[model samples]
Target: MRVVILFGSEMGTAETVADSVADALSAHDVSVYDMSDFAVDDLDVHDFHVIVCSTYGDGDLPTGAEPFFDELDACAPDLSGLRFAVFGLGDSIYGDTFNRGGEIAAEKLVARGAIQVGEHARHDASTEIRPKEMARDWAATLPVPALTSA
Candidate 1:
């Protein structure tokens, strides 16, 4: 399947995670994109997507993701058949807003009728865990035939 990995980063961590996810999905036709550069209308229902984003400013979407979500909101595009997965990077020290960026992105996408596949993965900065490793592992679980089968 055609897989697009989109990333939103404030300090490049999410971008790094995106690359990691891409590496794990190397067997497929995968492309990595910066959320700020991708167009909302370009999301095709026939393709699969992975979102890697980092929370910023008290659970707010990162700077790079702001434009994409804004455009997505404005366009209100129909994504009934589109499938996606999310990987969020955040610090647990933030309390209730922990990993909120990915949560918000997922919520918005779902609200627009996009179908989400796989578990919503999160990497907490407060932990000793490596974000890239977690993201790669999470991504590996997503490309299964059962998950992608229409």
Candidate 2:
């Protein structure tokens, strides 16, 4: 089972958390990609995808992810056989649209036929909860697929 981890970060905190999650998932043979460096076309070949993104000003996607999100929305790839999970990092201080980017990404993925495996993980940096912990826990809960011999 090959899993693709896609992430977007603004101030590097989210990126750090994403890296930790990727490192953990690597033990299970999952591949990871920082959305900034990953091509949108690559998503079509993945069996499963994990999106880890941070919500920026006014619920906006990080600068590095804006173009990717635009292309994703335009192409709207069909992910019928894909299973996905979403982890959102944001500040509750934003109030009205806290973690909105992650929510939108998850919703869009669902609309494109991806099945959500578990509840969306929302982490608030402004609060006492640590985003890294939330990401690690979420990674552990994902069902590991049997290894196939190449």
Q: Estimate every model's Cα lDDT from 0 to 1.
A: 0.92, 0.78
> Model 1: per-residue lDDT, tens digit, 76-108?
998998899999989999999999999999999
lDDT of 2 by residue, 1-150 (tens): 677788888887667777777876776556767787886677753566788889988998877667777887888887687788888888888898999978887887778887877668888888887778778887877664533444
Clashing pairs in 1: none
Note the residue pairs that clash in candidate 2.
none
Q: Give the range of the ten consecutive residues with the poorest summed lDDT in model 1.
A: 141-150
